[model samples]
Target: MATKRFAPTPTPSLLSSFTTRPCCLNTSLRALLPATRPFSSTPTPQNWLTPKRGESSKSRKGKPHVATGGSVRGTTLVWGDYGLRLRSHDRRISAHQLKVADETIRKRLRGTKYRLYHRVNANIGVYTSGNDQRMGKGKGSFDYWACRVPVSRILFELKGDVHEQVVRDAMRLAGNKLPGLYEFVRKGDPPVMGITKVGLVGNSEEFLRRPRVPVEAPSLPHTAQRIPGTTPV
Candidate 1:
């Protein structure tokens, strides 16, 4: 009677001939990289300047016009003591040109403890007319790309202890490199009174505040675009 000891028979499913491979975490497929597109040499000028008329409020609503130029909204940069600024009295500034100015300022401010900051953001897209295009065809078919600079706006701001002459020289080079005229302004100036302070550190306060300079000074574009994103040394 061997205590009725006996091995129970395996279940039908377990005894089946079907075979399955072991599960493995390392055997999972490799993750894929995100897709990216190359920037075109000539970017098409989409009608980003304005919205097309006749779209329903459902489609056009909640979509604000993209800013081409102006002080960065909701920001009060360059308000710190002794920081210098470049101000535009009229017209909007362009991005390609702004980058040129940024590079020029960096070149001047290099080898210093100072850090340069752009008070106004230029991610806003703008367009230009194609060469020899006829007038009056919806802003000339969006020829080239640029940024806008609003009147009474601060373009670039320099932070930290810096020489006033150095800032003036830097702004002069920057202004001359841009499309339109600009005045170097300093901290604590009355808001946009057409009064720009230049010489603050050394010499006469009045002389430093407003020096004799030409108006409508133009900047020639480089044959090849200057490299953007130069860091301070």
Candidate 2:
């Protein structure tokens, strides 16, 4: 005697699709509709990396003074001879970081005749977070403020009869916090030589985007044989 076998039938799924319109279709189509979302999670301002409403920006095409080369302004006969000129060799300084650096230098120059003139401006605003949420939305909310510092752009200049030593100390103190490479050139000093090690040697050699000598900024405050060593304090 032989036994008879039967085939099993397939069950239906909760979701269904049809080529033509049907009176009834399975699954929700709400997701298919377009939704409004921000391009980034961070909240963006009307304008970024530039001056805000009622904000003043000191614009100088070439230099502060044609003859003085922007290194000296206001009090030339007094503290003009001694002042530190900062330029961005590499990297960009954020608005917050710039503030910290400015404050640090100001504190160091306290009770002194040296005055600080800001060259770079912070106009960038950055947003953050919103990654955890579902996709297809927008940029995250604004997280913090920032600014871009271009290469070879003057950052700060100390004006007045500031002693070279004190200015050196102030530069070191300020440079410690600011990002990128900076040289403490005097008012009339020639542009510092860049220590860039670029060309590739072998397969082991690597390429650099910025290519600065050493990432670390100069540590020495000032040389021994410098004028305006220290104030009578």
RMSD for each model, in Å, please?
A: 21.1, 23.8
lDDT per residue as tens, model 1, 169-199: 8888888887665666666554432332223
| Candidate 2 lDDT (Cα, 0 to 1) | 0.54
What candidate 2 gets wrong by more than 4 Å, as runs, is: 1-50, 54-90, 191-233
Q: After superposition, how far is residue 126 of candidate 2 from its true place, in Å?
A: 1.3
Per-residue alpha-carbon lDDT of candidate 2 for residues 1-233, written as tens digits (9 for 90 to 100): 99898878655433544324443342335335467753788766443234565324322122121221222222112233443334443354567788788889889888987666666666545655565777756555665556555444456777776678888888888888887766665554433222221232321113323245667865655653345766543
Worst 10 residues of 2 by lDDT: 59-68
Q: Cα deviation in Å at residue 86, candidate 1?
A: 6.1
Backbone clash numbers for all candidates listed: 7, 19
* TM-scores for every predicted model: 0.44, 0.46
- Give the CA lDDT, 0 to 100, for residue 166 in model 2: 86
Evaluate all candidate structures by whole-model CA lDDT and list the values in order. 0.53, 0.54
Which candidate should be chosen as best, given lDDT against the real structure?
2
